[model samples]
Target: MQIEPFTLHVPQTQIDDLHRRIDMTRWAEQETVDDWSQGTPLAALRELVRYWREEYDWRRCEAWLNATGQFTARIDGLSIHFLHVRSRHENATPLVLTHGWPGSILEFRNCIAALTDPEAHGGTAEDAFHVVIPALPGFGFSGKPTQAGWGVERIGRAWGELMRGLGYARWFAQGGDWGSAVTTAIALQKVEGCAGIHLNMPIARPQPEDLAAPSPTEVRALTALQHYQDWDSGYSKQQQTRPQTVGYGLVDSPVGQAGWIYEKMWAWTDNAGRAEDALDRDAILDNIMLYWLPAAGASSARLYWESFGSFAAKDIDLPVAVSAFPKEILPTPRKWAERHYRKLVHWGDMEKGGHFAAWEQPEAFVRELRIAFGKMR
Candidate 1:
């Protein structure tokens, strides 16, 4: 598979359309949900919409992202957008970084500099890495997967190919959220050149009772898993069952689009209500616009159905490290992780950070990355 390169070019017309939609937004009543639990509140959406149109600057944000060496690549018929940041030193470890739902390569914004240019970021020059930050197959500029079989595991293969294509014979891997699971797959499945792996969030689901003894903690994990099914997983259900139905609403209104995307970000982050506590306002909007501009709000959701329907996570035999945060919805205990990964190390109770650890806490994020993967280097 060959990769493609793209100049940073966001058209002016799209920007106008987004602002126009924001201006024309007809908001709804705030049916009270004390916090952001129900969804993005109409009040907050209105305020954010106003700021996006009046205060936020698209070209400025685009310029910031453009500095990261963003480019496009074709692998197995998919066009992938990725950041290929090479280190100054020779023999730098290559690390493939992945992002999750409602996230982009933006999650790794702070960690990227630290990982690639370690010496500058207060690390040993020996800890340098050539980082590969890919836009997930359907999520961003990579374009959507039209045919079947582009589940999480297949995405893993595409990433491994991406790394090898870049000429890294061996590399380390790290991720948070869905990225964690994909990195998990890469490490477990023995992707070519994957030396070791690290994750902030663990790929978690209810385990069969017979597979291992369920501790009270494990039982609590199960209950939380079940609660997601009963209460919090409406997005998964809609995405899995009727994505197109929701897509129509998302495709039309930027306010509606904000509500759909922002709520997940709110719930997933360690913040109380403001995602800005962890993410930049423009950064959050950029992720939403990636979906809105591509009109991929529906197609991207199909990934949930695609991954869940067929390729579930397997018991992987690889060196794996996981950093579980307090707000992590999928808290895979060490024992549970041990059952799956043959070589499990570096499991820690993160005092801060939520699903998007790289975005939330980059220094601590880099510190953890250095601890787990710095060994490989």
Candidate 2:
């Protein structure tokens, strides 16, 4: 594995072009219902885009990426971008953190310091981790797959190779969203160096009997699943089936790209009416910028096309930990998770947070990982 330092510096012209696109966007009529039923509301989107063009600072984000130890390595002939932040504390555990859709490595930015330097972040040095945060192929600066076959299983193997290449003989993994699927793949592959895995979004399906004799937790989980299948899964369906078709707009229009992602920020976060309740306005745009600047709209979406149905229950015998946020897309019950993760080590039902756990509540996310991985260690 040949690795090299990578720095991010989006050209000023590109920033200007993004602003130009926002200015030229053809406005859509306000939704008939005043709610987010039709899509990202026109007034709300206008306000966000106005701030994005007039006030947001892309250079701050660029500087952070560069200072954060950005690096790239070619794995299986595809360039993979990652942040490698090693803890100065001796014997710090090697931990690879992966992010999912609508999330880039940026999702874990605020967590890096607390994770790699726990002593300074209200924890003993014993909780320290040497963090490796990788952008999934085609999602950030990572090279897009020129052909098919870059699904969860393949990505899992790549992560294993990446860890070994970084000289980590024993490491733990943590993830949510697509990251969870990839982490599960790593555990299932029995990757030699992988010590244990933690998932925020544990994908354990309900059995016939479990549904027939439902517990309160089971009922809530099943209800959320139904809601996802009914109203909230349109993006998944579009990406899974016709990524290229939708990419035209997402790639061409910055507003289109922002709205596509903003809706998820609103729907998935533990917010009170608006996404801004849970997330910073600029942080949201910073994430969207990753997709827009790299023009990764279609390439990133192709991950769904590649691994849509791969979120099934797995009989993983490796030590596992799970944090079930109350607002998670489908907060699987511990009983169901235990059925899949035979050696379940930790199960936490969080009081707050949603799909993007780390981004929504970095402190809680960090605490969960500290406690969960501590059990494995």
Best by lDDT: 2
- TM-score, one value per model: 0.92, 0.99
User: Could you give candidate 1's per-residue lDDT for residues 47-94 as a string of tens digits?
Assistant: 777888888777765787787788887888888989888888878888
lDDT of each: 0.78, 0.94
lDDT of predicted model 1: 0.78
Off by over 4 Å in 2: none
Pairing residues by index, what is the TM-score of model 1? 0.92
lDDT of 1 at 87: 87
Ten contiguous residues with the weakest lDDT in model 2: 330-339
lDDT of 2 by residue, 138-255 (tens): 9988999999999999999999999999989999999999999999999999988999999999988889999899999899889999999999999999999999999999999999
